[model samples]
Target chain A: AQSVAQPEDQVNVAEGNPLTVKCTYSVSGNPYLFWYVQYPNRGLQFLLKYITGDNLVKGSYGFEAEFNKSQTSFHLKKPSALVSDSALYFCAVSVREGGGNKLTFGTGTQLKVEL
Target chain B: DAGVTQSPTHLIKTRGQQVTLRCSPKSGHDTVSWYQQALGQGPQFIFQYYEEEERQRGNFPDRFSGHQFPNYSSELNVNALLLGDSALYLCASSLAGVVLGEQYFGPGTRLTVT
Candidate 1:
């Protein structure tokens, strides 16, 4: 079984300050991790993914995440926060092989970037 | 390229009624997956279609079903819907056989079961 966990239900950060949203996972085999952001009444927008090789991965909207194998973590981070960035963020995972890439997602964390 | 597209932006149905949602995959993509997202929760996989076949499925019951056309478009059908069936139906498309490929999602169809 593959599962993802976002420990925080919400994260509040001031504009122009750095921010982080934590995520962890468990999978029977190698894991493919992803981050997605969603606005109200809209579908999720892909942020970034960690397939392999690099521990640090950059994604759209100046977002990035680091994959930590030892800690089984993939935490989304931004150097500077923007009020526009406030939204619901989700962490998902799939097994490297088999399962047809069926993703298991976390409950999600509401990101609140205030000015 | 046009991203994934789903029809019926919003729908309202009563309990025990049936519903069908449509989806068109991103151009050049061959796989379509359906997900149901309940209020305040993450999206849960319903099933996936490839080559006009049901390739993968989640924990959903038999009442939840889908079909894929030769054009790679797909439809999700639910029978005897329950009030709990209300949710945001998301359609995602990705290229098959590409390990690094990421799924692209549509704006989603909101289903309100009363």
Candidate 2:
């Protein structure tokens, strides 16, 4: 079964500092990875995705993720974090072969960027 | 264009009661997917619909049913709801037959069962 793991339950960072949220996956075939952010009482917002090319993928709100095939990791990063960037982050993975389109997600990581 | 939209932003029901949540996919999107998001957890896939037919389904029971209209709108119906069913129900839409395309999500419906 394809699954994702977010090691941290919460990450605290001072505003204007760089931030990283770790994610790893286990899948049988090539993995399609995604990052999503959710605010309180709001639905998830797509942050970024890694499909075929480019190990480093950029996304909305100045977010980027590096896909490491050997380590099975796709960790989200930002150059400078803002207070508004604090939210619940989810890491998801899908198998590329089956065409099932089912996404297995991690529990989530709560990011708190304090000003 | 307007993004995906879900109706009845909030609902309250008692145990064993039924509930129906509606969703309208974003413009140009033909596939709709439903998810259940419990507090502090990631969203769980309930099912997916394309061309008004159920193309994929997760491990949900038969009590959780759905319908997709010709216009690409969808409805999720849950019968014999339990307290555990109280959570945020999210609806996402993507392009039809696209395997790895991004799915646009709507503001979810908050269902609370007492």
lDDT by residue (B1-114, candidate 1, tens digit) is 798999999999999999999999999999999999999999999988889988889999999999999899999999999999999999999998788478889999999999
CAPRI category for model 1: medium
* Model 1 interface root-mean-square deviation: 1.5
lDDT of 1 by residue, A1-115 (tens): 8889999999999999999999999987788999999999998889999999899999999999999999999999999999999999999998744437778899999999998
When summed lDDT is taken over every stretch of 10 residues in candidate 2 chain B, the lowest stretch is B95-104
Give per-model TM-scores: 0.98, 0.97
Query: Given candidate 2, what's the lDDT at residue B36?
Result: 95
Reported per model, the fraction of native interface contacts reproduced equals 0.59, 0.65
Candidate 2 docks at the CAPRI level of medium
Q: B1-114, model 2: which lDDT tens digit per residue? A: 999999999999999999999999999999898999998888998988888888888889999999999999999999999999999999999995676898889999999999
